[model samples]
Target: MQLLEERILKDGIVKPGNVLKVDSFLNHQMDIEFINELGKEFKRRFADAPITKILTIEASGIGIACLVAQYFHVPVVFAKKAQSLNLDGEMFTSKVESFTHKKVYDVILSKKFLGPEDHVLLIDDFLANGCALMGLIDIVNKSRATLEGAGIVIEKGFQEGGKKIRDMGVRLESLAIVDSMTDDSLTFRPNN
Candidate 1:
């Protein structure tokens, strides 16, 4: 996690409207070797959990989830922002509002991939207002699956998402928590 914090300080860009652009290495253009280190850290963090599947939202979270799943040796299931022709059968759905995009989407997941028998670990690139993760949690609840925990690469600690999720009794782990950010500076909450 210290490594991730260092990377953010080195490469992350702070934009107006509370956006921290990590696209250069974390999301848009990825660093697999770096992500693999993150994956190893996640595995170490949740090593005792009986994780059967890693669930994440589509787009940004997918790649990180896939990398993390390799360590867990589990399949990655992502909630699609929209329904598509390739999807079929009964589905669990929830509405999510994107903090960055300023839009709402009805996220959906196939019921066949999740159920009461499996344990799920939610993965994502960032946690802002918690809407996306809330949507995924709704889908998991609908499927009656056990929610093991959530692994987030970066969490905007200045925002309410992390607290809200933790208050709901979910185990949330964030590799780098930016306590505050400005155009010229960024601060991180120390992990202890």
Candidate 2:
């Protein structure tokens, strides 16, 4: 995770409204090698869990989740932000508020991909207010799938998201946790 922290310091941009834009390597134009490294780290972190499926929300989380799914040797199921005509079966839906987009979306997941037998590992690009993650967890619960854990690429430690999820007794692993970020400086929580 030190590699991720270093990368964030070098390439991540601090925007107003407590936003950290990692579009350069993490999300927009992805660094495949770096993302693969993250996948490996996530696998190592949740080595003991029986992960049958990797669940994520669409847009940013899909790429990271796919790479992580490689390590688990499982298929990735992303909750779509918009309902499409291709999706005909029953769906598990949840309302999620995006911290970055500042809008709420009805995230949908097909029931065929997830069920009571699945042990799901949720993956995401970032965790700030925990709305998106909680929404995914809600979907998992509705499907009766066991939530093995959650893997996050970057977590804003100063935010309540991490604490809230941990309070629910969910195992959450964040590659780089930013404890504080200023206009010119950023502090990371020590990995312990």
Candidate 3:
């Protein structure tokens, strides 16, 4: 996690409207080796949990979730932002509002992938207001899967998402929690 904090300090860009652009490394143009390190850390953090599947939202989270799933030796299930023709049968659906896109989407996943017998670990690139994550949690609830925990690469600690998720009794691990952010500077909450 220290490594991730250092990387954020070095490469993370602070934009107006509380956006932290980590596209150059974390999301857009990924550094596989670096992200692989993250996968290892997540495995170590959640080593005790009986994780059967790794769930994540589509787009930015897919790559990270795949990498992390390798360590868990589990399949990665992502919620699609849009309905596709390839999808069939009963599906779990939830509404999520994107903090970055400023829009809402109906995220969907097939029932064949998740069920009451499995334990799920949620993974994502970032957690802002908790909407996207909340949507995923809803789907997990609908599936009746045991929610083990969540592994987030970065969290806006200054925002309400982290507290909200924790308040709900969900085990949330965020590698880098940015407590404060500005155009010229940023501060991270101390992690032990």
* Candidate 2, superposed: residue stretches over 4 Å from native: none
Model 2 lDDT tens row, 1-192: 999999999999999989999999988999998999999999999999999999998898999999889999999999999889999889999998888888988999999999999999999999999999999999999999999999999999999999999999999999999999999999999998
Taking all chains together, each candidate's TM-score versus the true structure is 0.99, 0.98, 0.98
User: How many steric overlaps are in each model, in order?
Assistant: 0, 0, 0
Q: What is the C-alpha lDDT of each candidate?
A: 0.95, 0.95, 0.95
Candidate 1, lDDT over the whole model:
0.95
User: Which residue ranges in model 3 land beyond 4 Å of their true spot?
Assistant: none
- For model 1, how does the per-residue alpha-carbon lDDT over 1-192 read when each residue is reduced to its tens digit? 789989999999998899999999989999999999999999999999999999999899999999989999999999999988898899999999988888989999998999999999999999999999999999999999999999999999999999999999999999999999999999999896
lDDT of 3: 0.95
- Candidate 3 on 64-181: residue-level lDDT in tens? 9999999999999999999899987899999999888889899999999999999999999999999999999999999999999999999999999999999999999999999999
Error of 1 at 142 (Å): 0.5
lDDT score at residue 111, model 2, on the 0-100 scale: 91
Query: How much is 12 displaced in model 1, in angstroms?
Result: 0.5
Worst 10 residues of 1 by lDDT: 82-91
Score candidate 1 by TM-score against the native: 0.99
